[model samples]
Target: MINDIGDLLTNLLFATKKIIPVAIKQSIKDTIYALISIPKTKIYVFRLNKIISDHKKVKGYIIYPPTLDWDYMFQRPQQLARQFAKNGYLFFFCNKSYKSRGFKEVEPNIVTCGADTRKSLSAINDVIVYISWAGHINFFRKLKYTKLIYDYLDSLKVADSKGKGLFKKHIRLVANADLVLVTSDILHKKLLLEGRIKKTILVPNACDFKHFNIKKTINKNFEDINLIVNKNKPIIGYSGAFAEWFDYSLIKYCIKKRPNYEFVLLGATIGSSFHRSILDFPNVNYLGEKRYKVLPYYISCFDVAILPFKINDITRSTSPVKIFEYMASGKPVISTNLPECKKYKIILVSRGKKDFVNNIDRGLGLSRNKNYILKTQMLAKRNTWDKRFNLISKYL
Candidate 1:
């Protein structure tokens, strides 16, 4: 009878702990939204480059669609808004359906203009840069701008299968724009071949030197992991989605063969039968999804990082953000040889599972020389978001 009462008490406490926090969080969010108000603004930048220095004092707004919530990619809408606000740019985000409902009288500068607000883009008489492929085309067709720029950040066709149609639309948008900014040389070549002779520039992805300079200070979260790491034991790490494109079979093979080493997967596991099979491996450790800020900590724990992507059209025209992040971690990277990743000598390219295993061993055996670290840092510095945005600014 005493044991039953104790179990009941534990269950009640657990229930209360889970339920109370959710209700409290929702209440706080509502109160915060109600208390804060914004004024109407003159100019608006609709895309994600919220780090513009020139537009610090300019009266501008940002529009982020609700569609971003569909995928679990690294999205920081609130962060973007805050960054813009810090730089004196009025920031706002609205649901896609909000504008159509005529609920425009929320805030002046940071109004939640829904779908109907998009139509206002044409009459605003301000510069509008469309960042994504489909959204850029849709905005271009409707909105008139003093100077229009299409920031082709990725090859949509290779990024997702659903983006194939938008990829063609992006190509057309490239031809129509005043300036086109691409993120990869391979993509630049593809666009040029398709006759995109407009003011096109290649601006690769970038990292925050201050944030990613691991050599300066050891991140506290990583300090615990560092205690366990020894030169005698090699650690292989991969940080990203365990999506359909990820070669789990190759990962399994590597883990099976290299039983002595540890294989750590640090990311969200997609809900798929194939992904579930990865759990069967006793040597593999899935650290689950981590916050963006916490990622560098985990990455620093890795001896060698890997990009195990399957070769296909989806991967062919791709420029992965993880590649830059891996290099920024100052770890030797072994990637499956893909056309897009071939230009970087800092990465050891492999053809298949055999080559991947061999290269992983080679990378693990190599010394973490200062030359390699400097070379990796130089490459990462060149391909940062600031540089990418600067190239886009020229076209805008």
Candidate 2:
């Protein structure tokens, strides 16, 4: 009886261990599915801005899937909505969560669908185009539209591990679109390789320079520097999301090699390990996240700025707004060698860790000149959001 009881106990323990791992794996899978489904669930906001403001009268309707509340994503839609309102066009934004947030009243031009079945979309004018994939796929496919535009912001298959299914959906949408607006040259090229016949246009990411340039001064007080480096020491700063594409390991190497320079990272921590490494560094200062308007002050404080992006599908196609912002601040810059940035000789490009270190050293040693400042300012002037919007306006 004792032997039989021991065998049963051992078998129970083995089963429990196996079951726990399976449960954990299933939980992770559910979380990832929820994240990916976000874009499908929230398609109303993006479409409304596109259709509302191009003309005095609303000619069409636009649709967008729900997107993550990243600063970059939210700011564009909000800005577009404001622009559309200024143009006096009817706009409607819909989301499943809007009702839960106590948003019941439909404002002048804006309509809130709340969590209603998307069947209401059928009543929308067939003269207007409908857009979206995945969650809105069935709706869009069934719609008979005058014109459809698919905005491909990123090549999801290559850029995100969890977005492979979404990428396939995008391909189908692209085939269905009357026009395809690609956000990167790389994405455009990829579509061309796939023999996509859609009318494709490249529209790189943009920044609101006027907003960033607000209340610019030669000086601003930052307290974080005193504990990490000398107050008057030359500051080399980087700001943005600390994601996997960021080469923090390269940053770590460079900071270790150069003790004289202060490295300021102004963004949320990506991982605990990265956060610990950065905080432990004597010369490194992590200032967490800051308001968008406050970024210019931090940029102004930097003697030089760095864009250390890891070479991946995401970074390869990425046209970082910070590059233009750094230029706008009239600070000399060093960045990793990226194809999109290769056209601009204004930025110092580094191939690897050794090259990055060397470039930063060179940039630090260079004398700041009025001519250099003026040139950078000129570049910044040309790259402003208004100019980019004008180019986009041509297509509209």
Candidate 3:
């Protein structure tokens, strides 16, 4: 009897081990999120269906899968949704969890809500499911859609954070995608080497040319930056995430070599610990972050803009959107020799310490030249998000 009991206990333990999944932490979080979202489920489902019913005659629904919150960062996903709505497509932006009450029409035809609308998506036809993150494949696979798009924006080396099992998911996504859009030439070539993709296109990052080209009066939004830009020294500024790949050492070297210039840092930081290291320099001014609406004013204040990124696989694969915004703001850009930025003749790509300093000096002179400003703005006009979207629409 004792021997039989031990054997049964052993069998149960073995079965339990096989039943449990990998990514245990993420699984727990999902369970908690679903429990908390239960009350709002009907509300969101109704809101989602209401928008769908209103636009039943439109050219297919454009589904933005749960990736980032509608307000978080306001980058590519937000831009694409607005364009989709303007083109007469109903845009549904689903969030990871319920952070707010009810659904809101973020833009004219773009409605954003939480995950309660997920199951409802699987029932709808004529939907174009657009996803960026590889981890979303599991849920998105169940959606009823006429087309599926995977935007390969960054290398996997920098993408994972939640202890994700990404490799298999990425392969499945690429294999089954109706269209694979890459943001850089490197990423595009990567797909070509994979050899079995359906169709791939290179749709690089772009800017809101009109938004950044505004002539708004510099209000209190520029108060902090104004103090530095008003000084006799020319200001070198940057705006973007201060992530792990940011070359803080390169920025320190630049600050040390150019003591006469006022260096200003804008935007938010992520996984960055070199704040104390760089801010110690007296010439360097950390201006903190600003909203996307008022970001143009901050960019306008800079005499020259900089992209001081570490040369690595993650950055090499990136098509920096800030470069286009800086160009649109009519500011001369000084950057490290990022392959993507190298294509732009207007950018002053630096090689060594002396070269970087020299480029900054060159940019200061160029900033004042009317023709240089015009040319930079013209380049931005050619690479607007509108143009990038229309190109993708052709394939869609």
- The 10 consecutive residues of candidate 1 with the worst lDDT sum are 39-48
Tens-place lDDT per residue, model 3, 263-344, is 9888777754546778888998987778888889888888899999889888888999999999999999998989999999
Off by over 4 Å in 2: 1-62, 70-146, 214-230, 269-275, 365-367
The alpha-carbon deviation from the true structure for residue 59 of candidate 3, after best TM-score superposition, in angstroms, is 1.6
Over 4 Å off, model 3: 1-43, 161-165, 272-274
The Cα local distance difference test for each model comes to: 0.62, 0.63, 0.81
For model 1, what is the error of residue 232's alpha carbon versus the real structure, in angstroms, after optimal superposition? 7.5
lDDT of 2 at 44: 38
Residues 1-396, model 2: lDDT tens digits? 234554565555566775667677556555555544555324333343343343336544544333322133234444443443344434344454533321122444444344442444444455334342333444465545566666666547343557776767777778777777676788789889999945877766656666655433544265554344446777888987787788878999999999888888887655543546567888888887877756777777777789988888777877777777788777777999887777688888999999998988777765267688668767877876666556655665
The positional error of residue 303 in candidate 3, measured at the CA in angstroms, is 0.5
Off by over 4 Å in 1: 1-56, 59-72, 75-125, 140-144, 158-164, 215-232, 270-274
